[model samples]
Structure formats: C-alpha cells, structure tokens
Target: MINVLKQASEGLLYMSESEYPFEVFLWDDSKQKDITPECVLQKVGLPVDTLVEVVELDSFFEVAIAEQDWHNSEEKITVKKYQHLVQVLKKYLFDLQVMRFGKINIDVYIVGKTSDEYLAGLSTKVVET
Candidate 1:
C-alpha cells in the first residue's frame, strides 16, 4: 500500500496475485524470438480460446496473442480481450511488452477490463516505452 517499491530485483518484477513466488523476466530476443505465440501460452500456463492480435515489432520477434480462450469464454474473454486491443490495427508497427508472458499493454492505449486490473501485479504504471 505504500507508494514505494515493495520489492525489487534485477530485471524481475514483483506481483501480488502470484500463487507461486514468481519473477517476471523480459523475453530475451538474443536467445529467443520476439514472442512466439506458442511459447507465450506455455509461459502463461493457459490454453488458447481466442486470438486477440498478432503484433510485428520492428527489430524484435513477432507476437501472436491468443486471448485466454478458456471454456468460460464470457468471463475470461472480458478480462483478456482488452489486452490485445489494437489502437491502430493492420497498418502499423507497434511496441509491446511481455506482461508476465501472458498479459500485455500496448502504449497510448488503456486496454483490459480496467486500468487497476491491467496494471495490477505490475511494476510500472505503463510498460517502458
């Protein structure tokens, strides 16, 4: 609750809702692709229900975002849909951050169910631009 860093680490972010003591690491393209849609699901530990987007970064890897296509599509999609929202789709190169390998926030856009939820268990207000 304090407006201070509750925890800090080298390239790792602290999250509250984590069931396991998890550390978040950015996808190192030097060792991997910008974002493999398949690997991202494995990293998130969720199954595919709906695909929200597929972003192609300028220098890094391409990202195919499959919305958490769970059985309970209604509830889950409500929460996951906003993550892959395209402010300008099909005509632009965008920057994306690996938000826990599951969730992601595109800049200049407030996505997800709500700001509090999207920014929840996150370090910065918005991903580093």
Candidate 2:
C-alpha cells in the first residue's frame, strides 16, 4: 500500500483504461491496484472502521465502462459523467483532494509511468466544485 501511495505521491496516475478523457482512472495516487473507493479511503489515512463504503460507486463505474464504446477512441470523457464521478467522490471521500488536470500525464496506465513529471505542469484545472 505504501508503494502505491509512494508512486501516487509522485503524481503518477492509475489508469484503468488508456484512451483519452480517461475513465475509471485515478490521478490522485490514492487508489490501490484493485481501484476500490474503500482502498482509496484507506490510502488517504482514513481508519478502516470509519469507512462508509459506497458499493454503488463501483457498480456505477462498471456500468459506465461497459456502456461506453471504447474502440479506437481518444476523447473518452463526457462532462456529465466526469462531474458525476467527482460529485460521488466528494460526497463519500470529502477529505481526499481531487487531482488537478494540469497534473495529469497524457501517457496514463494502470500502474502509471511512475514519475512526478506532471506535477510541474500548469494548474489550469480547478479541483473544487
């Protein structure tokens, strides 16, 4: 778990799928390999007993991935879908900070590139609602 957080702290994104407008990806370096929100909370230093598990978020994500036509696509995110995900994360995991868009490395993967290169990029994307 520390390795995951260590990699994430360096600004390496965890990409579940690599297209563009990456869906099912976590830029915060807070996610474990399993990509469970519960694991995210755990990584952010939240105690296990206090976790308010939202199983629905996982289910929603699975549905979203299945519904999307991912064939040869570059632009992958819909504003509505992105916003909904942010809202859900905010609601369930308020303590964790959202990843800034400028911090995203375009070359995303499940384990990330293991570099903090994107941290030096522009902070054009607002993380707040």
Candidate 3:
C-alpha cells in the first residue's frame, strides 16, 4: 500500500496555495473505531492541544484541483497530477479524510484505512493566509 502511494505521489506536490511534497506514513494501530481528530493528532505525534480541523475529502479536492490559467502549462500539469493522485487514493483506500492542524501554517494529513486495517496515506504542510 505504501509503495502504491509512493508511486502515485511521485513528483506530485500538494498545492496549498503553496507547493509542498507529500510524505507517506503508516500508523499500524489505527483502527476504524479509533479514527478521531484527537486520536490522529496523537498518532502523528502532534501536540494534544493543537487545533485540528476536518474537511471532507471532496471539499479538499475541490479546492486542490481547481482549474488554473489555461495558458500556464505548469499549472495545468499540477492540476492533472493532483487529479491523478486523488483517483489513486480513492481507489486504494477506504474512509478517507483530510485533516488540517494549525492556523496559517497547517499540517495536512490525507489518510484512510488500508485493507489490513491500518491507517496509511500522505502528509504535507501548507501555508495559507
């Protein structure tokens, strides 16, 4: 599963209004019953008191894959890359989620349950005003 994620995310950057690379991570103890904002924070070693916001997967992708200028080849490529990554994540994972921790500078986790019941996916940082 990790290998699949690596291949899907290779050379693709999450456009948080800023470009950032995605890093794959797996949490062996995360079960479907244990998926909560607090639980995720703890598993990822984030401060327990840190602010956490949850956004639906589709909502995250709506902004992430928004159309760019038609003339900018780079921007077009980026959109395509994100689209492809989204498809791969949806195809391989279940109970997908998007979590943002913090204010202007946010830690983003796009995680879901793998077939083996472990939580695995990608994490990245985004700076937003």
Candidate 4:
C-alpha cells in the first residue's frame, strides 16, 4: 500500500500560493476512530493543545489545484497528475479528510483509513499569505 501511494504521489506537488511536495506516511497504530482533528495532531507529533481546522477533501483540492494556466503544457500535466493522485487515494482509502494545523504556513495532512484500518496518506505544507 505504501508503495502504491509513493508511486501515485511521485512528482506531484500540492500547489497553494506556493508549491510543496507530498510525503507519504503510514501510521501503523492509527485506527479508523483516530481520524479526527485531535487524533491527527497526536499522530503527527504536534502539541495536543494546538488548534486544527478540518477541511473537506474536495474543497481543499479545488482551492489547492485551482485553475491557473490551462494553456501551459507543464501546468496542465501537473494538474492532471494531482487529479490522478486524488483518484488513487480514493480508490485505496476510505473516510479521507484534510487536517490543517496552524495559520499562515499550515501543515496539511490528507489522511484516511487503509484496508487494515490504519492511517495512511500524504502530508504537505501549504503557505497561505
């Protein structure tokens, strides 16, 4: 599963106002019940007291990969690769959610439960000015 994720996320960058690479991670101890903002913080070794904002996966993607340059071949290819990555995640995981931790430069976790009920997905940083 990790290999599949690595392959799907290869060369894909999550673009906000800035571009960032997606890093795949697998939490062997994470369960389906641990798919909450609070749990996400702990899983990622963040302070439990830190604030976290939950955003829907589709909404996050729509903004992250917003249409910028349809005519540019490189941009077009990147967009398609991101879309494909999303599809791959959906195909392999369930109960997916986007967890945004902090303001300005936010830590984003696009996480979901694997077939074995463990948390597995990609994490990235998004700088919003």
Off by over 4 Å in 4: 63-69
Worst 10 residues of 4 by lDDT: 62-71
List residue ranges in candidate 1 displaced over 4 A: 1-23, 26-30, 54-129
Per-residue lDDT tens digits for candidate 1, residues 1-129, read 111112321232222233112222332222332334454545445465423344332111122123444546564443343223232221122224333222443211111111121211122222322
Arranged by TM-score, best first: 4, 3, 1, 2
lDDT of candidate model 3 versus the reference: 0.84
Better of 1 and 3 by TM-score: 3
| Cα lDDT tens digits for candidate 4, 48-85 | 87768988888888853555754487877777776778
Q: Which residue pairs collide in model 2, if any?
A: none
**Residue-wise lDDT of candidate 2 within 1-129, one digit each (tens)?**
323333322332223334233333334543333434344344445445542323333342454434355534432444334444434443333233222211233221222211331111111111222
lDDT of 1: 0.28
Local error of candidate 3 at residue 23 (angstroms) = 0.4
Please give me the total number of clashing residue pairs in predicted model 2: 0
lDDT of model 2 at position 21:
37
lDDT of 2: 0.32
Question: Higher-TM-score candidate among 1 and 4?
Answer: 4
Q: lDDT of each structure? A: 0.28, 0.32, 0.84, 0.84
Residue 59 alpha-carbon offset, candidate 2, angstroms: 26
